[model samples]
Target chain A: MTYCLGIINQLGIVMASDSRTNAGVDYISSYRKMFDLSLPGERSIIICNSGSLSVSQGVLTLLNRDIQNKEEQNLHTLENMYDMARYIGNKSREIQDRDRPWLEKDGIDYSCNFLLGGQIKGEVPQLYLIYPQGNFIQATPETPFLQIGETKYGKPILDRTITYNTPLEDVAKCALLSLDSTMKSNISVGPPINLVMYQADSFEINRKLELRIGAPYIAKIRKLWEESVRHAFESMPEIEWEQETNDSEEDIFID
Target chain B: MTYCLGIINQLGIVMASDSRTNAGVDYISSYRKMFDLSLPGERSIIICNSGSLSVSQGVLTLLNRDIQNKEEQNLHTLENMYDMARYIGNKSREIQDRDRPWLEKDGIDYSCNFLLGGQIKGEVPQLYLIYPQGNFIQATPETPFLQIGETKYGKPILDRTITYNTPLEDVAKCALLSLDSTMKSNISVGPPINLVMYQADSFEINRKLELRIGAPYIAKIRKLWEESVRHAFESMPEIEWEQETNDSEEDIFID
Candidate 1:
């Protein structure tokens, strides 16, 4: 299991992924799920994948191979973010189709998903969630975010905090906190989180971070967030027991 | 879909459920999912259920029928909480078995789950999550809560706040907040929410609430929690850009 999410705002895009991969409880390991296949100043292509390791790796390999071999149609040649998303989806579908029969024979799942987010020089920055079926949905200004894999535990924070107008740095912080929330609730999403912050129209990612578990900055943020959450919880107004409230109302009426 | 949870602490148990039930997105209605089957001064039994509405209703009907008919092994006759859990599980299995084939023929899911919590005289307060297959797991001192249906969105708070030592009223407040989080993230789970708080050895439940969506108390809590969460988020320490940190380190080393 993995948790990867991308937030797109007017300022730019923030993408984050947890690195833990497990075949089962006993065979746990870490693998970076985020890939910066950016062509630098020409285009910035950031991808985070979740699901079948073989399928995601196969798609990544095909993508990189295309770029390396200067294929006629490749990530670099895609005209816009939508084309790039379709290209990634096609690659994903190709991989899944090739592996589906063999995986099905052993009762294994071959499905995988990708969070594609970045910009081409002429087009606006965008984010997309590519489904396992090779279809994808773009993040609209109204939604402004896309998530794949273990999504729910981390979603409440994102749903509460993100908006299309939120600043890029704040979006990045929200992405990290969302990942932190997921890692706390689910063991399958442990850290050494990969994060990328791309400024709109910049065509270059200036802030890429690999926050390993127990890294000082992550540790500090985690501690601070925990203390803040506990403080907020403690300060919540106490419940007014309905029975007691009803009893008081009756007393008032009688008086 | 529905959202229901039960928390057992040293002082007592807190159980809550959202009331929305839908045949599909177009056909949504409200139905109470929490029931008090307690026989006061003898035992306190509270049940909250989620999943196939028909199956849950059937199980509830059966349990009530048995008690009304003065059956030998009704809820009132169960000697302890564990036996009561098994009884509910058995009843659930019976209902599912009776309805599974017919529901499966229509490609509908016949599965349902129950959160059984409270005291059966001569035993301590307890909580159990009864699975569709009629097997159940008890909440322990270490992990003091059980949840069913649309669970993950609300789980992080419970993971952070719940313990066997939490006060009964605080536990109830946490339960409401947990439900509030779920309701915010999922349309399938809505309110008015039914909540019950059982005091250990009291053999009666006096703090049951049905908090409607527009109820003043629920609205107050929701407003306060949203404000508090926003404040906490705003106060979170900003992320330190690793690029800047490394640059400063290099400058110091060069100097």
Candidate 2:
């Protein structure tokens, strides 16, 4: 019911998410799924969530509560990006476990997943996908992106465009286009897109935007991408049907 | 796993499928998924299949046996394209039912789906997607394509390009490209690709091609499409990130 992704390139990390959440067709509503947790000059943490809204809310509440109370093992106390991811994963599992029995009685699923990406004061920038089971995997140079929810429709573009050495601005643009493609194919993932870009080692979140359906920039990106894709398709070489011959039945039949 | 599709256009129907089947990573093999049945000039029926290989083989075996014996309710006895689809669906269901319990005992699935398309004498050209439960749905002018098995990766292009008004050759080209895209993203779907085209009212099967991984025409299309896509992506207008502003906290926070 959501589409969120995080990309790690040489310049830094780019995270994006759609804001639509629905309990059912009639209960559709907009709920922001990206959370920004930055400690001014010390650290910057961005978390993009997908799955049950209740469990996501519970995890976020506990995280913010820990931050406010300055808990011993809060986000602020985490030593590195991996530790931060582990903390988030553990909290997510805790919340899901708390509600699983009651929600299961009503046939509701309480599992949620998160994309945790940011930089700690002493560590290089990193990106991780935290699963509902409290396990996580970090992005590698060979595969520099992680996506959660409604991922297939938006995957081809990312698979073709992104790399570990891609520029920061270009990665951000690709992320937006990926979300735009998903929104077109699936109704469950709607607009009011949230995007954040963290320049490697900056420890500050200055480049962020929220785009709604009618926003001028959003309109420009959608129109340009559509036109470009159409142009690409139009220019493809025509199939040379005349030059090929059909094979005998023996060549094609397995049995 | 397989990727097969049928597109109905003004000129006629275009059907395509990949040739890979795998029970697991180590057991990958090639099995032709497209079968042709033509009474030449009287009827031209093409069937593309996906799912349990054993079930598909069983259904095909029964259909062939009925044809050999000139049974009263064989494929040649079908009155129209819809009737043909129903016949195929019924045979598929019969085969699945026969093996369902035994397969379940081994924790295996005995289900298969089919895309049946072609023309019968005195009937309009048609395409149908037949379910494992022995029910089928025909493609309409508004939504003129049906796909089965590993469909998502190839769907965006079909959504963007194909229509009832598209020319027969173009539709065939689009089907190949769709299969190409699926093969690129999913290892489960691979070459050699099988394509068949039927011109409306012809009541005969004349155009079909089998393309392998290194076939000259396949290589040409892949090169041209990749180049065109890269060019299109490069020409897209760059995003103006500096002009956008982050919204207030209330705009982004769910709580």
Candidate 3:
């Protein structure tokens, strides 16, 4: 299992992902799930992947090959973020189509998903959730985030805190906390977490981070967030049970 | 979909559940998921269920029939809480086994799960998670809670707040908040929540609640908890970015 999230507000986009992947409990390993497929100045494309490792890796290899071969519809050649998303989705479908039959024979999942978030030269920054079947949905102002895998455990915080007008840095902080919440709740979502913040129209990938296991920054935030949540819970109002005796007393008084 | 939780501490056990069940998004309905089967002064048996509505209802009907007929292995006649769990698990498996073939024809799920928490005479209070396959596991001090259906969203709070020594009222409060969180994150789990708090060795269920949709208490707590969580999230420490310029300056100093 994996958890990847992308949040786009007016200021910029924040993309985050966990690094842990496993074929089974015994065969756990870490791999970078976030890729900065940027052209520095022309177009900035960030892709975060989840699901079957083979399928996602296959899609990435195809994408990099397309770039190396200077294909007509590669990420670097795409004129807009929407086309870039379609290109990635198409590559994903191609890989899944090739592998689905054999993977089915062994009961292996051949599907994968990607979160495409970045800015092209002409378009404003955008975020998309690409499905396993090559379709996608864009994030809007009302719902300014897209998540790919193991999404629910980390969603409540995002639902409560993120908005279209949220600051870039605060969005980054929320994204990290969302990932941390997921990692704490699920063993399969352990980290090293990857995070990237893209400034709208910058067309450059400047602020990026990889917090490996036991990193002090990760520890500090995890500890503080846990404490804060505990404090919040302790502050929740008590349940006010209805008094059955009071109802009987009222009946007796009326009589 | 449903979300039922059971948390047992030294003082007592607190059980709570949401009331929403859906055949599809268009066919959603509300049904109570918590059951009080206590034989006051003899035993206190509370059952909360999740998964296929038909399977759960079938199991419940069978349990009631056995009790009504005074069957030799009925709930009231059971020797201990462990036996009660197995009895419920057996009933669940019986329903699934009988309906699995028909359900399979249409790919409808026939599996269900139950959280059975209570105490019988001469035994300490206990909690058991009965699986669809007639097997169950008990909750211990280290992990004092068991949850079923749409569980992950509500788990982090329980993991952080529940302990063997947590007060009964506090546990009940946490349980309600946990259900509220799940309902907020998922549309399939919603209000008309049911809760019960059973005191250890009392062999009675005195405190029970039904918070219907838009119930004032539910609304108040939901609002308060949302505020508390937002406050907690906002209080989280900021991420400290690594200074890339420092690395370059260090290199220049070495030269």
- After TM-score superposition, the amount by which residue A2's alpha carbon in candidate 1 deviates from its true location, in angstroms, is 0.4
Please give the C-alpha DockQ score of model 1: 0.31
Candidates by DockQ, descending order:
2, 3, 1
Model 2 clash count equals: 0
Maximum-TM-score candidate: 2
Tens digit per residue, CA lDDT, model 1, A1-255: 899999998899999999999999999999888887777788888889999998998898898888778899998997888888898899998987888999999999889999998998878888999999999999999888889899999998888778888778778888888998899999999889988889988887778788887888777777877777666777778777665442312211110
Colliding residue pairs in candidate 3 = none
Chain A TM-scores of all predicted models:
0.94, 0.95, 0.94
The window of 10 residues in a row where model 3 chain B has the poorest summed lDDT is: B246-255
lDDT of 3: 0.85
lDDT of 3 by residue, A5-113 (tens): 9999899899999989998899999987888777778887888999999888888888888887888888888888788888889999898888899999998888889
Docking class of 1: acceptable
Per candidate, the number of residue pairs that clash is 0, 0, 0
Local distance difference test, per candidate? Answer: 0.85, 0.84, 0.85
